[model samples]
Target: MYNDKVMKSALESMMFVWGEPLKVKDAAEVLDADKKVVKDLFLDLQREYAMMGRGIRIREVDGAFQFVTHAENEIFIEKLCTPVKVKKLSQAALEVLAIIAYRQPVTKGEIDSIRGIKSERVIDGLMSKDLVDVAGRSEGVGRPLLYKTTGEFLKKFGFASIKDLPDITEFDDIEEYDEETPHEQLSINFEGDADSEDK
Candidate 1:
């Protein structure tokens, strides 16, 4: 009873509705058709799209499938898409981000040691920006709060996961151009303009 044309139409409908990814089995179940039939339909559609000079194509990642623009046409697609400018994070914020990226699920105290200063304000700012989140509590003394990057961070940085972060074996390799420091090192600027205004 599974009409191939009807099944292909149903798969397209599912893709439009999902807007994320549609696995072959999931799409088949939604359309009440055989998985193999859905797979064949998908392959046919993919070939047809390529032949017809479509801007988009279907891709499978892990076990999930989704529609994406052709890599070769990305520049043209981007021009058509809305341009989003990301705000440049401050040095303190970037330091905090780097620490969380490398030593994830780390506590504020640990971050303070790595950067040699208190990071409560910077951490709060990152949290407010939705770049980081409370991962969990450490199983150490006082059970301090631990922080980790969120999916928003990955999306902003164009990473699918934190595992995609570049490796940093030596601390010296990290950027050392914080303006608040005397020699552009990682020294804390507790008496900066903001603190001076408060006094």
Candidate 2:
């Protein structure tokens, strides 16, 4: 009662509906067929797609299969979508981001000491933008959430890795170039942006 063509069509339908990776056993269970049959049918469809010059292809990752665009078509997709994906960051956010990037797993208190301000809102914004994330909790008092730059930060900044960051020595004289308050030195732009702790 198992028609090969009908089974193949059903497999495609299941994959499309899932909208994510589909495993061989999962597809077979849904179709009430042997796992080997499902895998063979999936392979057949993959070959057919390649031969048909389709923009999308089925790929296996970690023992699961999913539909993904061909690598050659990525540039076109980026051209169509990069602007909306790239959001601008404020100066304060950048400073906080830089500190987290260079000194990962650091607590907000540490950041406050270096930048001389309470960075609650700035850190919130960075988290919302997916540029920074809570790496873990510190062991000391209160077990404060430690923060670090995310992989998305590297991708957005075009850094291959953290080590690709420019040498800190190259920026040695940058501090002396400005005569503003400590807030300005760290480039944090917020109301009460000046040091209020010593106020």
lDDT of 2 at 109: 98
lDDT of each: 0.67, 0.67
Compose the digit string of candidate 1's lDDT tens values, residues 1-199.
6688887777777777887657778887888877787787888887877788777665443334556566566556558769655355787887888788778899999999988999999999999989889999999999999999876564445344566565556555464534432212211221121101110
Deviation of model 1 at 2, angstroms = 9.5
In model 1, how large is the Cα lDDT of residue 115? 85
Model 2 worst lDDT window (10 residues): 190-199
Q: Over all chains combined, what TM-score does candidate 2 have? A: 0.47
- Could you tally the backbone clashes for each prediction? 0, 0
Regions of model 1 farther than 4 Å from truth: 1-85, 172-199
Question: Which whole-number lDDT from 0 to 100 does residue 50 have in model 1?
Answer: 70
For each of the candidates, the C-alpha root-mean-square deviation to the true structure, in angstroms, is 11.0, 12.6
Inter-residue clash pairs, candidate 1: none
Candidate 2 lDDT over 78-169, as tens digits, reads 57754443345677887787778767888999989878999999999989878789988999999999998765554445343566664554
**What lDDT score goes with residue 77 in model 1?**
51
TM-score of every candidate relative to the true structure: 0.55, 0.47
